[model samples]
Target: MHLSVENLTFGYGSKPILKGVRIDGIGAGKVAAIIGPNAAGKSTLFKCLAGILKGTGNIFYDGRPIEAFRREEITKHVTYLPQEGASNAVLTVFEAILLARQFSVSWRVSDDDLVTVSETMEALEIADFALRYLNELSGGQRQMVSIAQALVRNPDVLLMDEPTNSLDLQRQLEVLSIVRKATKAKGMTTLIALHDLNLASRYADQFVVMSDGMVYASGRAESVLTPQMLEDIYGVHAEVSIDSHGQTVVTPMCSARNRIANRRPEYAQLAV
Candidate 1:
């Protein structure tokens, strides 16, 4: 399945967060990175797609409007992992993951649910902490548990807001690798909001660069993460280049104080 958003807009009171944003070509099994500066509406877009927040726009999944799906259908197909969640839930790691799985099961948990939870935890490398309480775990460990919870649901559309938050360098890489594998294996459409441009370029098949509530650019990392695009949207004087591995590398040398001049209308027209 493919996800498309056209003329999407949302706001609080009169202040808008998303201004007629259009994103396309997010197909099944592909990981797209929702990237940009702070308050760029990456999280808001995820919420809208997950049906958590109602926003003005036409969101289509495989050419069907999002509104056509019932609440239960949305819940079953869309899985959202927010940037922050209550970490003091008085539940063990295993129990927390099992609870997430229970959302799709009956009152009496089935053997499939148990096996799914176990497999998800093992895939995330958090199976060792099954007996540990959520309150007693570190921030990174809690994040891992949260991830395990999201993965066990086995949704078609996965929206993860900064899944790497609070994780150390090694853990970040490990978790992302698992997520990508899961996405491809299940043919899931995954969108991840990431601040680390290098990591986004590495893991994401497509890039959606948001700036000031609009998509400043969308396409491959090499096309969207240019030096000029970085200066225009992020006000950073950066060097963007390809490494020997063909990965896009962003090196911010300094900040361009006169950022207003860099915001060109032509950049907004960029798309894949």
Candidate 2:
């Protein structure tokens, strides 16, 4: 599947959040990371793509406009995982995952549904928490369960917002690995909103950098994650270097605000 966005615009009342944002070349079996500074509209963009927010734009999946699909049809092809994972539902982890899978099935849950939920839980290493109440699990555990819920749906396009948030180092790696593996195996188009540049560079095959509600840059990490981009978009001085494993690593040195203030005195207050 190919996912493309063009002239995407959205906002609340008079304040605009996205301005004619366009991204392309995100196809099946590929993981594209959406990176940007705080309040850069990353989450808003994901919401628009997932049909959670009504926005004026063109979103195409597999060369067809997303607006043409019915609600149920869209659900079959797209699964979105938001940033926060806490659920007040009284259901257990297994029940939550099973409910997600059951959305597509008209009949009663069968042996296959149970097996699929079990397999997804195991893949996420949350099988032990199957019987635990969702409200009782810790933040990280709930996040893992939320991921399992998304995976069980087996959508063609997976839109994840900060999927690794609240996770420890080990769990972070595990979640990303599982996502990458699943994307490749099922040829799914995965768009993940990530705050960590190094982690994004390590896992994503492509990068889309957003700034001020628009696309600042898009392409391979090495090409897009340059020192200049760091200074321009993130207002930070950073070093982008290839690690021993041949992966791109970003190390922040200092705030680029001082440098910007020196160059553009009119906007000096941003430095503070």
- Write model 1 residue lDDT over 1-272, tens digit each, in one string: 69999999999999999999999769999999999999999999999999988889899998999999998899889999999953688899999889887654456788998999988887788889899899999889999998888888999999999999999999999999999999999999999999999999999999999988999999999899999999889888899889999999999887786344346555545521
Clash number by candidate, in order = 0, 0
Q: Write the per-residue lDDT of candidate 2 for residues 1-272, one digit (tens) a residue.
A: 89999999999999999999999769999999999989899999988888889889899998899899898888888999999875879999888889888665465898988998999888888998789899898999999988998998888999999999999999999999999999999999999999988889989999999999999999999899999999999889998899999898999988987665678866766657
Question: Cα lDDT for residue 87, model 1?
Answer: 66
lDDT of each: 0.90, 0.90
Q: Cα RMSDs of all predictions?
A: 6.7, 3.4
Any runs in candidate 2 off by more than 4 Å, and if so which? 104-107, 258-272
Q: Which residue pairs show collisions in model 2? A: none
